[model samples]
Target chain A: MRPIVLATDYGTSGAYVGQLKSAIYTVAPGATIIDLTHELPEFNPRASAYLLASFLEYVPPESVIVGVVDPGVGSARLPVVLEGDGYTFTGPDNGLFSIVARKLSKARWSEILLSSEPASNTFHGRDIFAPVAVQLASGSTPRLAPAPAEDRAGIQWPDDLHEIVLVDHFGNGVTGIRYRPSDQERIMKVHGEKVRYAPAFHCVGPGESFWYGNSNGLIEVAVREGSAAERLDLKTGDPVGFDAAG
Target chain B: MRPIVLATDYGTSGAYVGQLKSAIYTVAPGATIIDLTHELPEFNPRASAYLLASFLEYVPPESVIVGVVDPGVGSARLPVVLEGDGYTFTGPDNGLFSIVARKLSKARWSEILLSSEPASNTFHGRDIFAPVAVQLASGSTPRLAPAPAEDRAGIQWPDDLHEIVLVDHFGNGVTGIRYRPSDQERIMKVHGEKVRYAPAFHCVGPGESFWYGNSNGLIEVAVREGSAAERLDLKTGDPVGFDAAG
Candidate 1:
């Protein structure tokens, strides 16, 4: 059986995910459709890209990964399939595969121009990417779809360090910092001040703040029994800094 | 936020899935835990094995897949962590990963000897596997805990031709055939006659019997707007046969 993972910005409240699954199953009856996440924050391609890149490696080889964060559904934005390292990615030409391609040894891409079919202005997830993914999962070659346009721009991660891309459900601000146990013995510096590590989110003394590298390889700031984002007045994209000192 | 996928046979009725997620979040604060499926049949390792082997590739790579379908929880059974390309799988040592490992390269297995701790007999999904999965999600090493023994016996797919593993929500008896479209196109010679394929479950001719693959990839025998399992005296695990032709 073939496995297909779907990552989309479509929230779970609608028929978007269901319709897409039905369409795929319509074409490939044996295909196992896995929902990576339909709850990606709406139309946030960067967020979608990060979420996809972080989890793409776990999918089995030969599995088709369908990403539909397309804000440019019916526009000139091209639908593309990136094939590499025993896996395939199908999504809009928007930089969805850029981060993914960086992680693989080899990647070949093709653009999907199936826009001539009757498609909705609002839902390319159901119309475009979903069908293309079904075809791929059914053993159709990537090149069988429309050829990808040459010189199309791929996505790029920000390098200026001006914003952080994640916030916890409890509103704790986290940065992309890989944590190590050795760092625990050292004094942690966040935003230029020495801080202590809390055992749990609430382990810090009341009103006392701290920083630690969370399991997801990110630096998280939290306040005991309180909202850290509220206490620090931090939002999702706010910039922060940290350093470990002996 | 980090994504964690839960795969279990606990079925979605009780507080099992909810409590597992609560325990996970309590340990790894602010993490987003996704329920892959709680609808797996109870205590059926082969079904859980097949389901996980089929769908685990669709989840994000860093996501922790927590699978609990153990029929031998508090006994000599072992909790295990199997690390493979881009994903981590936590479950009992009942051969859940055996099917998946055959399809992947370089699987690192570790036994979680957490049985020595205070644990529950009925709910290892909540006590052992869930907590260990949270620690794993929080970036704990698999070797952090006592090493579980390796080379445990794996699950064997039932060789009996007529065995059924699941009866879905719609009362469709899902057989082990794992149907594909090619199989659906070819008529199955059953009971000394060719059984024609019905386009949909309800597409069977009036007062006629039909069989076809349902949307979830299981071969189903059904009558239009009727229960074929009941009419045909078919219960789960009963042996049934279809000619290889279709």
Candidate 2:
């Protein structure tokens, strides 16, 4: 069975994540559901988009990746299916899919039509996206109509967002900037602190702040044996910049 | 394939939960893993025990529930398997499973004999607990020997604790007290505040503090449309009291 990956802001503590999984299991009892992360910059799809995209390479190619940071749920935003680079995507038409679409070559956008079934205005993640994800993951096509990728939200957004997209439990700040090898020579500036490059946590002294390419290929800020978030006063949506190391 | 349920203090943001899942999937590719919750009271298996026991009713009886809150990771703590009330559990031989065992009838304890395989000392959740959970869930029992249940950690702990065991994302404080219908007329006192009973959040005015039997059948303190944790200055390990409501 094709795996189903869930990315959402519903949070793990609440019933929302459980309800979403139930919807999927109700449809596909044998489905393999992987929670990429439910704590996705709550309700901020623009920031979540980058984090979700960063995890794309780690997911199985046949996986159905469901991203649901829908702040405009029950609004004018349309539910969408974007299949690209051997993976299928399902979620609201908000910029949640924009970065993933751009990252995956030959992406095709399609709108998932409502089947005259009523859904909760506040929880389309469980009501709509989950079932559609299950359908695609089960090798069944959902009701869809070809849509213009250009008209999608965040289509024109920058490829690289120079902002903190997520903060891990270890207090490491994950930026939206996809790391390149040459980028390691630059100093990262965030919260008015200059963070030099470090290959790994052990490369720096305890409590020393540094930046490095994380496993997901995103530039991340961390402090050895301490919380970079606390040390730098960093949080999601905080601006970050790069400069040539002097 | 039998399902595997995970309950831990790994928190949602870190790689621990993902690594745990990956370990199970690596061995049992078709396994269905449910993350009961990764945000258990960190390193306090005494508190996590009550919270884990409360969630047992919601899990499928055939599940292999893995509970890990091992502060003694590589220490002298024994790794064990517990079979009880139609469910199988694998984790450190800590108090994490004590409350769950007490709640279930006809519980049996078994020690999981360590193989010659090298395992990580710090991440037994992934290396030890997960693989053992998958083994039991797959109908293939691991090497085990009968152990005395009385000698296990937390065997003498209270049936119901009066301290806060968890503070969820919504800021509700879930106490270790199991709700009884007759207790409705009683007032719960915590953090120097007296809280009356309410059947549901809707029964209380916005921002009004009240206690209720939450879905998991635990007595929980909450403030409608606001944060009970913030309002009462409540947190895990905080003591609570009960009094007859006049």
Candidate 3:
């Protein structure tokens, strides 16, 4: 079985993540589970979509990603399985898989039909999606209905989000803007502060805040040894606009 | 090969943890890494010791437990590998493994001698401990020298601690005390306040605080649908003394 990459809003200290792994182990005992992350910004599938897309490029190829940032858990939102390039995503159809779908155009997708199996209305991520993720990772054909490529029901959001999508443990806010890396000075204006871009933390002065293309190839705001969010008083979903002076 | 369980103070939002797992995977390609927890309170090995001991029972048997809460990382403090009943631990010998050593008495231990291998002066958890952890998990006996169990250097702490060892994300404070389950009105006094115990959250009134034996069999302070740490002004290592009228 290919590895299962678990990405969820289930905080690390909690029991939910443990149960998710237990679920996978019970079904696919030979499966390997890698945590892409669990401390995803709570209940924001749009942001998780980009993060899932970004992480897909870094993880093991042919890996099955289980993305679960579902806020509309018990709602009428459909559950989904997005088959990206050499990777698979299992989550809600709440636009969580949309960016991943966009990232790999040749991607195939399907909707998990409504089920009567015992599950909590608020935690389908565990009861519903996790079991299906194991099935996919275990090389079993899960019950899936085709979701056409043109079906943009969950993907009404913009292609490249301008808002802050992720705030890391160090309080570095990762923006949704994708850019190529270069030594040339790149700058982004957030709120009223101009964040200069550097290639790495060493290139910037101590305690200096800068934007850089991170290991994941996305523009990120960071401080050399301090917190970028704290220094700039930034939060997720805050806008980062192009620097006019640049 | 048994699984590799990572217990560290390395916060999740940083690159350190990803890099740590990356280091493990580079050496032990088949190793399945389970993050026992990362958001350990920074640099307090006493609490981390108890937490590590508590987690040992919950993880997979015969697993390699890589514990690192090294405040004295680059110092002359020895690095050690403890072989437990059915598990192994590799980390700094700065009392991080003391509780686990005490928990399983038949355990054997060894020291990883100062080596010529290139290592970071600061980040030894990544440079030194993670690689050793991978070696243990990958069924390789890393070069280890005999260290007597009677060596009182790290195991001098009390068998059962009386102070708060951990304060978790939900603001619940976990103490190093243990107790049996019963319906009796258990009580604990802290900071001139008498805290009564309840079995589950539902047993206590909403927003009321209580002490109980948590899942890992340690006493914990929690508020039902509220922040116990915030309300009680609790931090790690704060005193949680015994019940007087028990």
Best by DockQ: 2
Query: How many residue pairs clash in all the candidates, one count each?
Result: 12, 0, 1
> How would you encode candidate 1's per-residue C-alpha lDDT over A153-242 as one tens digit per residue?
553464223234455444455553445556675654444455566544334455667766543344567665456667667655565654
DockQ of 3: 0.10
Error of 1 at B12 (Å): 14
Model 3 chain A lDDT-worst window of ten: A178-187
lDDT-sorted candidate list, best first: 2, 3, 1
As a TM-score, model 3 comes out at: 0.62
- Give lDDT tens digits, candidate 2, residues B146-189: 99998999988999999999999899999999999899889898
Best by lDDT: 2
Specify the CAPRI tier of model 1: incorrect
Once fitted onto the true fold, the runs of candidate 1 whose alpha carbons sit more than 4 angstroms away are A142-156, A159-162, A170-227, A243-246, B1-246
Worst window of 10 by summed lDDT in candidate 3 chain B: B114-123
Query: Which digits, one per residue and each the tens of the lDDT, describe model 3 over residues A44-102?
Result: 87777776676655566777888888888788877888886788888877887787788
Q: List, residue by residue over B114-160, the lDDT tens digit for candidate 1.
A: 53663334467767887788778877654445343346546344432
